[model samples]
Target chain A: MNLDELYQTVILDHAQRPRNYGELPQATAFAEGNNPSCGDEVTVYVKLDANGEKIEDIKFKGAGCAISQASTSLMTVKLKGKTVAEASKFEKTFHDMMTAVTLPEYPQGFGDLQILEGVRKFPQRVKCATLGWNALKQALGGNSSHDPVTSENE
Target chain B: MINAEQLRNDFPILHQQVNGRPLVYLDNAATTQKPLSVIETLDHYYRKDNSNVHRGLHELSNRATEAYEHARRRTAQFINAASADEIVFTRGTTEGINLVANSWAFDNLKPGDEILLTEVEHHSNLVPWQLLAQRKGLKLRFVPALANGESLDLAALDSLLAPPVKLFAFVHISNTLGLINDAKQFCALAKSRGITTLIDAAQSSGHRPLDVRDLDCDFLVFSGHKMAGPTGIGILYGRAELLEKMSPWHGGGEMIAAANYESSTYKPAPHKFEAGTPNIADAIGLGAAMDYLDKIGRDNIAKHDMELAAYAYEKLSQLDFLRILGPKTNRAGLITFVMDGVHAHDVVEIANTYGVALRGGHHCNQPLMKKLGTPASARASFYLYNTKTEVDRLAEVLHKIKEYFTR
Candidate 1:
């Protein structure tokens, strides 16, 4: 219910100036995430290391509400340089944080992503907060299918 | 004039607060709040005459069937249909359109026949035809909206209404843009060409007085919920001759006159189309809603709607950062706009903090949004109960939202 909590200063800043934005043409894996209800869409592109086991870089390109854009922007900053398994683990943790009935204790090493926990209070916006993470999860899930990942299905 | 302040008292839900603020329900286009009469009607039906309609011989069954049939007659009268037999009940506007598409178009149209629609149709009006076109090898054409994104390009109608265009289906009002199309003129044009016409009056029915006879459209569809009735009830009015020609879309209990394992004889037009046990209680509730609206006078309500929309549009236009969609004048009871730096969802979310409910998204008009050059926009729709003061509140909240996002 607190507007300040939902639109944290850090989240707003990230949304205004997203990190690692735009297409990664040399990317190995990429997937699009869409929230059809609100018309929010983001494509997360991942560049894995030589072994294809670790994400060397991650980037995104799309337009949406601040929660969606910022969550994806912050996600790129968190997942880069982490192994695919670790990224998947973080995704599960992030999903839990967003979907929890009450504010769970902040998971360590989540960094600025903790600001998104405010999304838990607004049930309708949970999809907006998770849209980007769902795409990143899809990119790393090895399907790399052409069909855009939807938050509704996840 | 209808006193909105007095009318607001009839809606119990409008008195509540959201997030510690008085709720300003500007989402009327999505669904209008039900009146006490409608709510009581629903309760009365379930509490007293709760039985299956059409076939029951018991006292309750007779009451239920009479009430259900009375609702059908009320709907026919509400829209000024030539006869109650012309009215078919469906889940809502979407179901009504799908019913016509499946029953009428499926039987009549041939492969390569084109259906003329507007660029501004809601998905309900567009998608059914798309599915039908794919299935029957039919072609589809569109009448584009003007560059202003308000009115349909009537100039283009002549070219699009070529011989192959068998049916011309369009929205009576743009749910997103709030533009009221000239249904009468459009219907006349289609009729002159000997092409069948269907009007999507989902937005127009309760907000304004409607006469299917006056519009002269072969088929017209509208939802009860949009007009202050219960959900899951709507009307599809077809001309008597046309209704007789169309086959039944849903096959079940009430639609049949005689049944055997191999085949069954179907009832007349309206009953034949309505298969299974109908939404008896809600249909009766819709009748009550029509009574309530009639008491207030739909002409007065229509004037109030336009006044509220015009007032809201002026208030919103004062903000330098906002770009309003739809025509500047003669719009329905709504305003759709986008803030310069704020996403529509964010605008809606922040406005909720102030208890001003708004609709933000494609509003089931994705292609129209694309043409208008915005992914989505925020809309504040008014009804009979909404007032200029609420429009002021909306404008104030929008200003605060702009400052919050920009600062």
Candidate 2:
């Protein structure tokens, strides 16, 4: 229930000056994630390599709470230059970190994302933390048909 | 004068601490905490008389049926409906509105008819009509909010009330803005135009004195949970004449008069509307809530609500970075505001750590939020159990939240 645990310094920094924040004109896949409960929306756009395996570029655009914005910003930074399969694995690791019963060990390359592990203490904000990742997952799954990824479903 | 300090004793949940701080609950607009009497009533119903109503031949069944019907009568008296038959019990206000939309509007409204609604309506009041309009080839029109986003533009109502408008449905109080619209005046205008009217009294019913006859609305819906009752029970009060004419929304066991494989006849009005085995215990609990509210006097409660809201509004107005929504005067016991450069979810999360419960979202009024040009805002709604001290706690927490974020 501690506020500091949820709003860590790095999380706040990323929230204030989000990295890779905007639309991607040459996006190969795109999806919008919506938290209907709070009206928070994040549109994730991805441009894959010509071979369609690696994520060459990634961007997100939306307005939300500090957790949602910061989580998405850190996600774009982590997923860039990784293969599509690695990005999915990263998402699974992040999801496991947020949902684990006890504070699990942070693996290598976890980086700033480890700050979001505190979200598990507040079950309600877990959805806020995953709002962007849900859209990222949709984009990687080839959701260019523009179906919205709702956190409620997850 | 209503003593909120004394009233707090009746609501046991108000005495607890959250996050190592005394809980200051300001989320009453979403749902009010149930009083001891309502809780005891539910306990008593389950412990003593638990049985199906209207179909059983045993003593427990008679008792359950009596208590269930008594709840209907109490609900009728709570809103001053003409008779118990006028009150049709539904799940809550959403289901009540949907009931009217399906049973009455679908049967009466034609392809080209338009349903006029206000811009400040909660999604429950707006969406049901939208779905119905889409299905029946009907058009939906809105009475826009004024520039201040506090009240409706009554001047434009003259044009919107013209022919082809079969119904005018609106909220009695804006859940997001906290403005109490003039239900009596609105109903009168609709009556003059020969258009039926439905008032969503979900926010107004428990906070103030309501008289369906006095307001002259054709149909009014309210949730019991918002008025110190249990969830899963609400009342939809339609004029007896209208209830007699409209068909039932649900069809099942209890509503039938005579049934066979060929065809079945249905009972009249209220019973026909309540189809399956209803939430009998919660209905009884709602009856107890009505009795509790009556004993305290709704007029005194309304006065207390207004005092707290005004006090909170003035107190929060001191903050330079806060933008308060709704008019300063003549508002319900709620305040909705947005802070500079901070999302409502953040404000609410920070406030929660200080043991202040707030609703941080569009308050189910997305259309109104869109009109106000904000994605979301934080709201603190007061009730009879709330006090000036709690409002002070909320104000203090807001200051801390602002400082924490801005630092």
Candidate 3:
């Protein structure tokens, strides 16, 4: 019931002024994710480096709650320089954490993403924290070039 | 006069606390808290008369049959239908609408025929026709909401009632906007044009007086759960002649008079629609809910609702951060709003911390949400058992949410 745990200062700051919050004009990959229950939508656009394996640039544009927007913003920062495989691994780790089955030891480099681990206690908010990650996965997985892939919490 | 505080005692579910604070339930539009009268009715039925209706020759079957049929008669009187035969039991409003869409409209409407609806219909009232239109190659036209997003445009409605428009369906009260339309006048207009009319009265039947004979709509639908009754029970009031003319929606035992290897003949209007063994206990519980509401009186409930809505609107509007939806005048028993910087989910989360339950979402009116240009909203709906103190608490929680998010 503690509101501060869910709406941490970092979360609110990222929600208010999200980093890399714009449409990527030079994007090679794109996907849209929606939490229809709460109307949280995030569109992720990624511009991959030559060879199309490493993410050269990533940006997200959408509206959602503090947790979702903050998670998306933080995700763009953490996954920018990583290869597509690394981003997918990170997404799996984050999903496991939100689903409350993360390993005790942190993955090699969790960075600021640990702040969102508090969401594990709030079961209803797990979907909010993972919406952006799911969208990012959709962007990196194949079919990003064909149609704007859309994903839901369900 | 209905004393909400006194009536509150009758609902045992309201006495609990959530998250260490007194529970303030404002989600009445989604479903009402079942009163002890309804609960006890269900208990009594299950305890003594738990048998299949109109099937067995045992004493319990006879008792169950009598109770279920009596419940139908009570439901007919509750809505002031022309006769009990006109009231067909369905799972809920969604099923009732589907029944009509499948039985009446499927048979009556053809390719190029149009069904007139409004922009503010819930998905239940809207989606069935959308599916039917796609399947039958029927055309659908909408009467757009007025500029305020509260009332319907009568002028557009008149213009759209051109030739080949077979039926007109609309919600009596918008669950999202909390605006009550004049169903009688709307029905009269459609009736004058010789168009079949249906009113989705899921929100209105519990909060106001409903007279099917007075409204004269060809079809009316409402749910039991929204009226302090059990779930999985609702009524579909169709004109006797129209219901008789329409083919049976679902085929099964209770709906048929004689069945053979070759074919089957159905019963009269009401029985012909109710296919299988119905929700007998919940139907009896619905009767109990109606009896309870009748004692309180729907007119008084309506007044209580309006007073609560007006009070909440006046209070919540003071917050510059909030934008209220629906009519400023002559609104229904609920208020839906969105905060300037706060998402409705966040607003609901903080309100939950304060032990207040407000519905936060599209409210199954996704198209209407798009029309309002907001993805979702926080809605606080009132029932006859709600009080000004609860409204005040809601306002206080909303203020706290605004202050919490803005700070």
Per-residue lDDT for B1-407 in model 3, tens only? 68999999999999989999999999999999999999999999999899999888999999999999999999999989879999998999999999999999999999999999999999999999999999999999999997648678888888887678999999999998888888999888888888999999999989999999899899999999999999999999999999999999899889999999999999988998988888999999999999999889999999999999999999988988889999987878999999887889888888998899999989998878878888889999999889999999998898888778767
lDDT of 1 at A60: 96
Q: After superposition, how far is residue A14 of candidate 3 from its true place, in Å?
A: 1.0
Model 1, B330-354: lDDT tens digits are 9899999998968999999999999
Better of 1 and 3 by DockQ: 1
lDDT of 2 by residue, B383-405 (tens): 99999999999988999988887
For each candidate, the alpha-carbon lDDT, in order, equals: 0.92, 0.91, 0.89
- Predictions ranked by DockQ, top down? 1, 3, 2
Cα error of candidate 3 at position A8, Å? 1.6
lDDT of 1 by residue, A6-96 (tens): 9998888888899999999989999999887788999999999889999998999999899999999999999989889888878888898
Clashes per model (N, Cα, C within 3 A):
0, 0, 0
DockQ of each: 0.78, 0.74, 0.77
Error of 3 at A11 (Å): 1.1
In candidate 1, the residue pairs with backbone N, CA or C atoms under 3 Å apart (3 or more residues apart, or in different chains) clash, namely none
lDDT of 3 by residue, A1-154 (tens): 7889899888988888899999999999888888876788888999999898999999999997888899999999998899888888788888887874554446777778888988888888888898888888877776574343333442
**Alpha-carbon runs more than 4 Å astray in model 1:** A100-108, A142-146
Per-model TM-score on C-alpha atoms: 0.97, 0.95, 0.97
